[model samples]
Target: MQLERGVRTVKLKDLPEPKPRPSTEGMTRITGRGTSMLQSKPLINIVNVVASATIDQRLDLKDVQKKFPELEWNPDLFPGAVFRLKSPKTATLLFSTGKMVCTGAKSEKMARNAVKTVVQKLRKGK
Candidate 1:
């Protein structure tokens, strides 16, 4: 079979017989007289997740900032307003076109929750 690009073709019969590996099921490898090498499980963690969403209707950033005094919006620095939530610990960017980008969430569910929470807070401003 051709395994790689610009390489020679390997025939099935030309290959040496594969040796069977010793089963290590429920057993550890002994390196020293009393020391055994045990396989370790990998550590994995979800640190951050980013999610974006769009509201159909156009938004008035000034009006939103007026209603929610806690929202940070400076036209000179950025066009989007920063809405921060403490529960899911996320910051969502709100634009005049009604587009939102939520960041600093730990997982997909937390990202969705943060977006939904921001939407709900905006709805309450009306």
Candidate 2:
């Protein structure tokens, strides 16, 4: 027996209409244990680290890799990007996720200040 090898045909009229999605205004109830409480206010958390300098221009994958040899700087995997700067006493790691962890910083204030500066710069750029 010989099998046919050709393009198949279908009529558009035979197709069914696509289902409509729920409206945005509708209330979405949560049933999970962790999120039992209703979130009346906005949930605020850090998610981006703003650098003082223009990050896209000043920082790159190679720069981060060179400064922090410990971290594997894969731009593709970490799409947000990372910035590393080092002084005589301190080394700072700023992630796209609004969190900066500093090592060898002179003081806690210095580390906090650095993160604040970066956050300001990022916001200004945006």
Top TM-score prediction, candidate number? 1
Query: Please, what are the lDDT tens digits per residue for candidate 1 over residues 64-113?
Result: 99998989999899999999888989999999999999999999999999
lDDT of 2: 0.48
Q: What lDDT does the true structure give each of the candidates?
A: 0.87, 0.48
- Model 1: lowest-lDDT 10 consecutive positions: 20-29
Give the lowest summed-lDDT range of ten residues in model 2. Answer: 47-56
lDDT of 1 at 33: 86
The superposed Cα distance between candidate 2 and the true structure at residue 50, in angstroms, equals: 17
> Model 1's lDDT to the true fold?
0.87
TM-score of each: 0.64, 0.30
Q: Give model 1's TM-score versus the native structure.
A: 0.64
* lDDT tens per residue, model 2, 1-126: 333336655555555755536542344446686465343454565434332322343444364456446554566766534433443233455555434555544555665666555455445542
TM match of model 2 to true structure: 0.30
